[model samples]
Target: MTVKTAEDRLHDVAIIGGGVVGCAMFRACVLAGARTVLLEKGGDLLEGASKANSAILHTGFDATPDTLEVTCMQRGYALYRDICENMNLSVMKTGAMVAAWSADDIACFPAIMDKAARNGVPVKQLDAQQARLREPALSKDVRGAVLVEEEHLIDPWSAPLAYARQAVENGGTHLCRARVESGVREGNVWRLDVAGKPAVRARVVINCAGNHGDLVEAIARPSPFTITPRKGQFVVFDKTASDLFRTIILPVPTALTKGVVVTRTVFGNVLVGPTAEPQTEREFPTVEHDALEKLREAAFRIIPALRDHDVTTAYAGLRPATQFSDYQIEALPTDGWITVGGIRSTGLTGALGIAEHVVGLYRAHFADPSPLANVVVPSMPNLVEERPRPWMQPERGPIVCHCERVTEHEIEAALTDRVLPAGTLGGLRRRTRCMMGRCQGFYCTRRVMELAQSHLPGLVSPTGKGRSDV
Candidate 1:
């Protein structure tokens, strides 16, 4: 429960942004034996682009070969598997299938297979009959598919939370609502002006800002890339729809986007869509009714059985996409800054690997600190439906959210977490899966507010009577 303050001490590395990548960076830098600090602009971590995603742990089978993206993805995928069990994270190995519905899509199979082979990923060619045998719910019109064996699903929230928690437990500073407004380097040390806080001194600054990456990069030097936020909208069906499919259903790859995908989430619900539409808006990614309708139509076309199930909710996430197809990771030795940008859909899988690569960059260009001899590894609460939940145990407290079966004990634990407790309602939801089920927050908001009102700031109950609602 010890919280480190970034007061007068100079940090070896200061990471900007609190997205998944930033959390991973903080963990990497701290474990590398650096005095690290992470400054976030939001009320909680993952308030930006990392908050919403498909949660697919990609195998990089379709990534461009010999590229940084592929390398980072493969390494991240490996690192996640190595630490998942220790951190109590969950990985559902429900392999993916590139289902082809038309002759043109089937024609692209050879190139796809060649790319997978080049990337050293194992894939199988499944004929229509074979594909349907694996997933009987698949449409009979499916011509063929390429089965990607290593592609899987993961708890996107818990993975990053574990990373940040470990870093904080092992002597790292995590400051929320501390946005970096400007920076100036003097004698190999950078002095950063964080909004509403005293100046921070760091030997090196790493910008992991998701949507505001280019803007952060501009503070160091003229940014080489321009961030054009690409919006991806998705639909989540009720848990009953999870029975409609086993394998993740993917569409044929196009130049612009990955197209819509139909897959089951780790929380035992079916998911679909994520239409890649580019827009100028940076902060909020609003879900349009038309876009959501189109996504539902697309999902129905992919899995007709889904028509019988009700949709729980729909959401949209903004990706920090640049003009370049590959990741934009480079160390600016002269400016004492490093920029990690253009990480779009694969960020969840690439975050750990990206951390390793950035650590290498810091060692090669900046100071090479000794690695921590005793690294503290923290385990996260099991939010994955496949794992044992808190409510399943005998000593568990009363349930707060019946839809998700979230227990009062789990909510309290999340609210009082020592290293990084839930600072906002959204953070609490992500931490304990509370208010995220079919009923959303209708059944549990009052109880949750009662438990969290004192711990969280500016949190009021449904009764609009200030804090008296508690």
Candidate 2:
């Protein structure tokens, strides 16, 4: 019989959350030669704000001038290609446009372009005729627009999954369903307790707990900031609307929201809405009919042709808004805990730079670090519309999920993939795009679950909290 250790070994750093930021922190620590461990309360990954996020890779053109968001967003945008290429994540370089439906919106173009320049993003100004010629689906009343040439659409869930996979393969540890209820420092080490699991001890603790970041910080020490949940609801149109545009159609941003946008996903589906409304219930991801109508109106005003397409699905995402506008990342004096909070909407675009920032804080805490060589990047199976299906090439087994073109081989890989196995339908969807198409898995859910049960026994149940343990 194999001997199991009585307790887990102490790590150099123990990150509290498994969201994008936390996974990025874990990857950074591993790259910087730190023995890091990531603890997520969920059974899988991306359970919070990261789950329902719009898949747009922002250009930070409209970020508030001279803040951490602008700096990190700029870096993230620039680093996007290199990172995605190494990890095999699909990214659509289909640029973006901020459409002006009114004279006021038209007047804001010059200022918007100026702000884009300040954020180190180049944008082009287009007149109404010029805009109409580019996208015939756009509304006839569009006066003018500002084109952000670098804005791209990416696979939103892939980055976190890839980062976590890299960290684990590179000697970092990941604990799913390991929630850190409390942490206390004894001498030079911080001990963290997880429900129904061994206590994880570390010399440094970093909190990347998304919307519950404040709660995670309170577990170790008092929180310096409060995270107010801001809900943004969105509607996705079927891939039949792919011709609507090859780029993102943005609106004049307000102080609080990015306004609703009609943008293409990497898989060719068009997404609309993301109506920003402040809410306190993090558990409720309910979509409002009124908000759905408002988002539809917004999409229709920009692209009238969008009205002809069927609404595939609608969902909501929460952003961690705080009293301060910029991100709150600081090392606390009490114990070795650093808080990463208030990342809001830009978290997806800024994931890499935020990792660097947290790594710098990690170095500041321990003071000794060594330069590490290039970490191996794992190649992911492409799920983009353009990529040929497994059945198209090899004689893979019968197709399982017809809605998204997911095949049996692909489903098996998702079920047994070493990086992050799919234990739930949601997790499987994120991995293989199963059950997310127009039919919404009505045709394939049962067949897929049957495959899951055969390949990944005891792990394929659909649940309210998803597959993640936290």
Instruction: Output the number of the lDDT-best candidate.
Output: 1
Candidate 1 stretches with Cα past 4 Å from truth are: 1-5, 467-470
Native-to-model Cα distance after best TM-score fit, residue 156 in candidate 2, in Å? 0.7
Tens digits of lDDT, candidate 1, 1-470? 96645844689999999999999999999999999999998889998999999999999999999999999999999999999999999999999999999999999999999999999999999999999999988877899999998889999999998999999999999998888999899999999998899888999999999899999998899999999999999999999998788799999989989999999999999889799999999988999999999989888887888899999999999999999999999999988899999999999999999999999999999999999987888978899888789999999979999999999999998999878998788899999889989988888889988898878777775564454311
Relative to the true structure, candidate 2 reaches a TM of 0.94
The weakest ten consecutive residues by lDDT in model 1 span 461-470
lDDT of 2 by residue, 1-470 (tens): 96643237878888888888787788888889988888888766777788888788888989988998888877776776777887888778788889998998987878898888887778899999988888888899999889887788888888788888888888888887787887778998888888889888888888888888888888776788898899989999989999777978888988888888888888778898788788788656789999899888888888889889989988898888988889998877557878889999899888888888778877776645784676777777788876665767767778887778889888888888876786555677888888888899899877876777644434444432224222
Clashes of 2: 11
List where candidate 2 sits over 4 angstroms from the true fold: 1-7, 454-470
Shift in Å, residue 303, candidate 1: 1.2
State TM-scores per candidate: 0.97, 0.94
lDDT of 1 at 198: 87
